[model samples]
Target: MPVHRVRFASVRSQRDPSAPAPSVDAREAAEERLLEALAEAAGADEPVTALAAILEDADPAELPLTGAGRTRAQWEILATLGARSLAAARVLEPHLDALSILAQADVPAPSGLLGVYASESGGVTLTATRLTKHDDGSDTWRLDGTKPWCSLAADCTSAVVTARRQDDGRPQAFLVDLRHPGVDVGEPAWPALGLRAVTTGPVAFDAVPAVEVGGPEWYLQRPGFAWGGIGVAACWFGGAVHAARTLRAQLHRRQARADEGRGTGPDQIGQAAYGRVDRLLRAAAVVLGAAADAVDAGELDHACGMVEADRVRGTVAQVCTEVLQTVGEATGPGPLTQDAGHAQMVADLQVYLRQHHGDRDDARLGAALLEDEHTGAEAWW
Candidate 1:
């Protein structure tokens, strides 16, 4: 079959002839031009570069939100899915998430630098990284020690990290430049079977200059924290959708083969699998949409917001797991072994879904629900 190419940029150009073309890097410009030519190609390639160019051309402040200007949380679900379809969500989602966090926290980020959030502090155990405020009369802050699970550690130009305050032992968020002196991006430690492109590893800060982003404990206490948690679920949902697409394609191929006397027709087992996955995905979408609406309505301003976010994330994670099992069983090992994209999508979805905290999160939700019930608060229907 001959591939038809459709350049997305050309469509925009045709719509607005007088729109000014923003200046971009020569290499990026060349890549965009090439992609424009390949838009109608049977297999569109270089989705990461294409998406990056589109994002760069727009002002970060004006990105659309999901659900009637509901917080960016809802919009993230669609964005993540689009990136996942191109097999680039692992590389792009974190950078976008960082930008969203900074905007929510009201942190001023310089234009064009990719931002990362690396605030995993090992729960109760203090992270090796520590932020110290010197007695010397200056606004200077210094970061020292090692931070683990720093995604995009080497690639990000800047990061928002959590460290224990030397003065009062409170955890605080600090913005630091990766290019500054005394910052070392460690060798990659994320050699897991999936998300190889994410590049998560340790980062050592040796008196690296930084500025505190918010007040002590503000990062977690802020409404945006819950909003961000739900956003991760959106990415998981997107990846799941991509995995489900493989199963749908395989089913179609089997049906076609049967019609041509090459294989059997769709059977009861395939029908059941399709039905279950369809229902699960639909339910998940509803939950995500409701959560997005709640966020936009400022429902996440209190404990209820956390409850809703946790429920949505847990429910979505369960749905993704079910979809993975259904797809694997119905399609067998053919797609896993024969299709590279399908294999990558399956592996990536499995790893990314682990972002959910499993029993811990469920327990938290259970306790909150019980508390609400005890207080005679309105039942969370």
Candidate 2:
């Protein structure tokens, strides 16, 4: 799908041709389409096939490009998908992020699903070596070693991967074809509680052919790097939204029963818990919205991307933590034990939230402030 065209989910009335599309409408529409496709493809023999079907149905242009004026629409869709299915959102968000990344680099996305894998770990790294180009002016390279945390490696046909260049020792982004003969997707570390449907594990590449995207250090230096991180926070926030909704549902059940004179209404404690959840969730949403607007306005055009992303990600992570804690306390062990969906959501959110570096990220932010004499706390204030 062209990034230029958009097709909303139509949760409300169809968009008026003269009017701009709203973020909430796009979110609901995409969620409806995704939920239906997931329901229809639920019984597929393989998870990858099911995932492919759902993704193939979701138009790449469903939400406008981030910073294309409808940036909030992009995040709203991400949050709703996270609310519906983090496993599914886990796969889809990167696919969408890849589209924006490719657009930023003036590269046309290849047909089929794409993944954005940038993570690396100790003792396991993917290295890129330039290969002799064909007479057709192709810029190809070979990749070797293992790239960790490659979610849906088997499902994606292609990916925008970041690998350390052997010549320069600097990381560069590449538009890689996962179908290359030298590529090998390893077995997932299964039985994991969160994002179980998404096959996230190590991928071993042996001389895998690839096409370089932007030059060395281009991927991390790009503004999309921070925008992409904020997208993940959008998923985290959405997961919290669902968790709060689950608690709200339990409260409603209690209140309904009490209205019939059969049980007591929501007590002060439960009501207080809901209030706290609501406050945190809305605050996070506001931060996300402001961040979206800033991106669209090109406010982070310089090098503030890292600082901007850390603040939003850290705030959202803290809120998610508090919401999970309060909900668990208010609802007790019933949802954890009795409700499978709620249980899975809570577990998935917990594991996904770990992507946020917690204190390490906080320290990074504080250090940024302290190291730069020009950067005072009042700048943030």
Candidate 3:
């Protein structure tokens, strides 16, 4: 039977016709040009270098930010779509997200410090890194410990890291110069199956000089923290979109061969797979859009922001996983084994989605919801 003869057509065409179409002319001409440039540069041999060059050429002040003119949700859509275009390009998304959060949080950054947020505390629970304030009558801080999962560790000129203060033992945000003496960017600890181009590893800060970005616990307490978390989901969604494209291309090729009477069309199973991926993508998009809208409306400035961000993160993570599985099963090993880009995208996305803290995050959201109910503030409809 023809692929279109399956229920996939009806399922895909179920969009509400009465709903207004999303605006395509949202970005300014310059922004559009920058996006095009980034897309082209994303395919470069060194994507990080290309990203840095693009950032240097573009006016940092004019760069897109959440809640800046355009709807925050729309910005997320654009961001995810951009990331989806190139798997390697996903590396730049986190830095951009950090920049956006810093701006939103009103955190002061040192001049000429290219920001990469390296606040991953994955291994810190077992072994905490301390950044003590050096009370030498001078405004200097010393970092001593190893930070794991430092993405773009080597490429970033500076990074915002969370280190416990010696004064009070509270985790605080600090800006550290990657080039500073005693700061060691360790060997590639990310021996994962994907995201090889975006080098991440353990960074050892041996009494490295650092400047505080915000007060103790300010990094996690800030609204931008939650916003930044949701932005990660945007990147995941982008990666999933790319994976979906591989499946789509495979289906198209099969259909073309069928049209030429040279091969069989997509089977009912293939159509079902496509439908599943479509539903996952659409659901993830809706969650992201809602989160973006919340951010734009300043709903993320309170406890609600954390809940909403958790929702987006969890939803996007699930969608990406489903996309990976569905696309893999639907297209078989052809794309994974033959298409380098598809394979890399799959690998990159798999590793990236692992950033989600799984049940811990879900538990946090659940507890928050329970607290909301106790306070009669449960507005999660």
> Which numbered prediction scores highest in lDDT against the true structure?
2
Q: Can you give the TM-score per candidate against the true fold?
A: 0.78, 0.87, 0.83
Query: Residue by residue across 1-381, what tens digits does model 2's lDDT show?
Result: 111111222222356788975566656566556555653453355645776766765666663576667677778767866776677668768988888888888787787778998997757888999978779665779898889889888889899998999988899988888998888898888787887878788888898888888888988888888899998998888788878988999999999999999899899999999999988887888788778878887886535767778898999999999999999999999999999888988989999999999999989888876765653322476
Model 2 misses residue 30 by how many Å?
7.6
Worst 10 residues of 1 by lDDT: 3-12
**lDDT per residue (tens digit) for residues 347-380 in model 1:** 8778888788899999888888889855332345
- Residue range 216-275, candidate 3, lDDT tens digits: 678888777777777667777778777877888888999999999999989999999999
- Ranked by lDDT, top first: 2, 3, 1
Query: Which RMSD does model 1 reach against the true structure?
Result: 8.0
Task: Score each candidate by Cα lDDT.
Answer: 0.66, 0.80, 0.69
Q: What is candidate 1's CA lDDT for residue 160?
A: 77
- Candidate 1 Cα misplacement greater than 4 A, ranges: 1-58, 65-87, 121-139, 373-379
The per-prediction tally of clashing pairs is: 6, 1, 0
| CA error at residue 109 for candidate 3, angstroms | 4.5
- Using lDDT as the yardstick, the better of models 1 and 2 is 2
